[model samples]
Target: MSALLVAVLLVPALGAAVIALFPRGRDHAARVTGTIFAAVTLIPIAVLPFARDDGWTTYSATPTALRPWTEFDVSWVPALRLDFHLGVDGVSYPLVALTGLLTVLCCAYTIGKVPSGGQGRTLVALLLVLEAGILGTFLALDLILFFLFFEVVLLPMYAVIIGWGGDDRRRAARKFVLYTLFGSVLLLLGVITVAVNAGTGDLAQLTGGTGLSRSTQLAAFALFAVAFAVKAPLWPLHTWLPDAHTQAPTVGSVILAGVLLKMGTYGLIRIGVGVAPLGAEWAAPLLGILAVAAILAGSLICLRQTELKRLIAYSSVGHMGFVLLGIATLTATGLQAALLGNVAHGLITGLLFFLAGAIKDRAHTGELADLGGLRESAPRLAGLLGFAAIASLGLPGLAGFWGEAFAVVAAVERGGGLWLTLAVLAAIGGALTAAYFLRLLRKVTHGPTGSASVPAGIGGAEWFAWSPLAALTLAVGLAPTLVLAATSAPVRALTEALR
Candidate 1:
């Protein structure tokens, strides 16, 4: 099992290296190799549950104190107290699986729609590197290892956005690098502070707040919060996201929204809260307020957005707000909601970006004013878009519903007047979410087909890329227990540790 886990992390890196070795202009070879490697990466994740002693059902059982499954630890830097530690528990397993699933889908999309100015070999190699980075972040159990993996994603994504993106790609890429690098620096400082104070950088060893003073925990948590908030792009710090999303190629947008953003929220749970429980409690109120503010602000911004990709990007802000709100509650239900919301957003939003890309491909523009009555000319494409939009709007019986609804429910359960207020605001944000998406549907999918030439209905490669997400959305929506069960026990253990 340990070897399999190692393979999971190494496969993408190896693929990236192999793809780099391919000569330029071997576009077909690059795409095929990338897709095969991406798909192969899923094998270990799929087998992980069964490999454990308690099997797949163990995730639903009670979780113990801070122990991880399939741990692989080895000495890396003795002087700095760093070790190469990697593992996944129930909390991380679902996310790791989600990363693998989305990477494969994105690679599939790349096969048919390689972006202009993106040499196929370079693009595929970058995607594989990005995949490895995201997967490693989820699996890493040492602070240094986690940071290394987290930083690994930066350059590749910057290259993807600037190399293959739209008119303002360079500017957007620069903004992205600046904001994230600032966050990364803070993240590094916080990690080093925790390691020096705790005498080790192993997360498994520091699971119970590292025995640090309240003051140190507070400072570290603040640094981590700001750093993650930048990546999570929570409110005031979120200016770079819309530009990056709008300018990025389709696969880039899918991976960005699907997996990259989750890194921040996941860190909040796994590192910020996990390592600094006192700090999390101290900051919960402020976090809640900012989360609600993001919810309202993002939705309101979406209502006015003229570009399809930009609107979807803003919608991510609101959706992530729900995840943050859930995290702020510091309850088992809230944590579970956060996990569910994370995966749901990955699936639903990934699909939305794919649909948005399709529309843009056919219409050569993302402006809502320029697109209308898509259902008239591209019924299948419009139908899929409608489904994804409805799911994103938190309609009942879809993946998006449980996460937002339970987040509000969790907040309501928190019971203080302030929490109740935030809950009400979050609910209102949900309504606003519905409003903007509905308005989007009305403006783009209905009325008369606009001047842009509609391409043939969703293509084979697109259907292959999209079907998994669409099916998962419906499956998880109808059976919330699928994900909720996986996360509940770990969340219980985490909340218990905090208490």
Candidate 2:
């Protein structure tokens, strides 16, 4: 099983090497090969839950520690006490699978259509590199290892944005790298603090604030809060995101909105709260306040945006804000909701970016003033856009509903002056979410046909790229237990420290 985990981690990087080394002008073959490699990573992810250590189920229903279903660990640097450790438990598995699925889809999408500035093969290789980094971040059980994987994503993504994005791509890419580098510096500091003070970087030993004094935990969490907050782009730190997402290529936007932001939220869950429980409890109120602020701020900003892609980019702030809110509650229910919101946002928002990009491509302009009556011209595209928008606003029986709704429920459950107020504000934010999306629908799909002429037909490649995201949004929404099932025990164990 450990070997299987190692192979899964290596496969995408291998795909990248193969694609990069492919013969000149073999872009088509290189893309196909990259997609195949990406698909290969998914098989092991699906099989992992069955490989759980004995009593994964029995442990909590029977009382278990944080036991991963699959893990591979080995000594790396004896001096640093850092091991090359990786594992998949309920908390991280959903994200790993999300990363693999989106990467493969993006790779396949590339085979049919390459963005203008870059070669298809090159884009495919970058996607594979991005995938490997995201997967490694989710799986790494060593704090330093986690930071390394997290950094791996920065450069390739910047390359994608600048190499293939719009005319202003350079500026957006620069803002992205500089802001994240600022966060990375803090993340490195936090990781070093934990490793030096605890005498180990192994997360298996550090979870629940174990092996550290209260002062150390508090200090570490403060550093982590800022680092992950920047990554999360929480509220004020979020200025760089809209530009990056708006200027990025179609497939790049999908992956960016899909799973990249989850890295920060995941870090908050796995590192900030898990490794520093006391600080998490102490800081919960402040986190909740900022989360609500993001929700309201993002919603209001989105209501005023003129471009399609930019609106979708701002929506991520509100969506991710919900995920952060769930994490702030620090209850099992809240953590489970956080995980669900994380995955659902990937599915629903990925679809939204896809539809947004589709609209921009056909209309030749993303300006809202230029696009109208999409339903009359391209009903399928408009319909899909409507479905994705509704799901994103937390419509019932859609993938986006459970996470946002449960986040509010979890906040209310936390039951204090601060939390209760946050719940009310978050709910109002949800209403504003509906207002902006409906306003979007009114502008794009319901208004009289605009000057821009969009084709009535949808392409095979578009359908191929989009169907799974649409189907999964409905599937996960209706049966959220699919996401929540594996998460129960691990979330419970993490929350135990708070209790």
Candidate 3:
């Protein structure tokens, strides 16, 4: 099991090396080899859970909330007390799986279609590198190691955005890097505060806030929340996401919305709520307010957007708002909902970006007004687009429904003036989500064919890249326990810390 953990982290890096070091002109072969490497990663991920030598086990953890079914810990810097410690349990495994799945799909998509600004091989290499960073973050159990892994993703993603993105890619990439860098600074400070005060950098030791004082927990969680909020792009801090998503290439947008954003919500749950329970309780109301604000603001803004990709970007802000709202509730059900929301967003939004990118590529535009009557010329493409939009709008018995419905339920369960009000408003936000999506379907697929070209066919690569996500959306929706089954114990453990 430990060996499998090592494989998940290193395989993608090895894939990137294979692509980048390949002969300069062998672009097609490089892409093929890179994709095979990416595909190989899923094998370890799929097998690791089943191969757990023992049931979930805990180190000498406080409140006994930190458990890893498989773990690897070694001294990397004896002087700083930082170890090359990594682990996977119910809490992080689904996210790790999501990252692995999405990267392979994106790499596969790149094999057949390369956005103009960069060779497909280069983009594939970056994707592999990005996968390593995301995997490391999910797997890391040490604070400093987690931060290092977190920062590893920034540069490769910036390159992807600038090299392969749309017409204003430069400015969008700049904003993406700058905003996230600022967030990183605060994140570093938060991490250092926790480690120095706790006299250790291990997350497991600190999950119950044993060594930190109340005031320290308050200050540390503030820094941590804001840092992650920027990455989560929560509300006002979310300005970077739309521009980044709107200008990024299709695969770039897919990866960005799919798994990159999950890092923030995951951090908030694991580090913020885990390390500083009192602070989470202290700030739950304010966090809930901001989350609801993001929900309403994002949905209303989407209703006014004129571009397909940009509207989808803003919609992420709204979708993630529900995830944050769930975390703010700090209940087992709420946290579970957040986890479900994270994976669902990765699948549903990942597919939406793929479909949107296909539309843009065929028509050479994402402007809503220029993309009318898609169903007239391309019924299949339009049908896929419609399905994705419906899922995004949280149709019942779909992947999107459970997370959101449970989030509102959790909020109401919290039982306060503030929480009840939040519940009502969040339900309203759900209605608005439906409205904008229906409006999007009407404008893009229902009207008379616009002047822009609409391609009627989806190639094998697109289907190969898209089919799994579409199928999984319904699969997870129909059998949500596929996600929640592993999550029950870890979530209950974490929530117990809060109590």
Model 3 lDDT tens row, 115-182: 99978899999999999999999999999999999999999999999998878999999999999999
**Cα RMSD (angstroms) for every candidate in the order listed:** 1.8, 1.4, 1.2
Residues 97-132, candidate 1: write the lDDT tens digits: 999999998888888878898687788889999999
Score every model by TM-score.
Answer: 0.97, 0.98, 0.98
Tens digit per residue, CA lDDT, model 2, 57-80: 333432214577878899998777
TM-score of 3: 0.98
Clashes of 2: 4
Task: Output the worst ten-in-a-row residue range by lDDT, candidate 3.
Answer: 55-64
Worst 10 residues of 2 by lDDT: 55-64
lDDT of each: 0.90, 0.90, 0.92
Error of 3 at 261 (Å): 0.4
- Structure candidate 3, residue pairs in collision: none
Q: Model 2 off-target regions past 4 Å?
A: 55-64
Write down the TM-score for model 1: 0.97
Error at 455, model 1, angstroms = 1.8
Highest TM-score: which candidate? Answer: 3
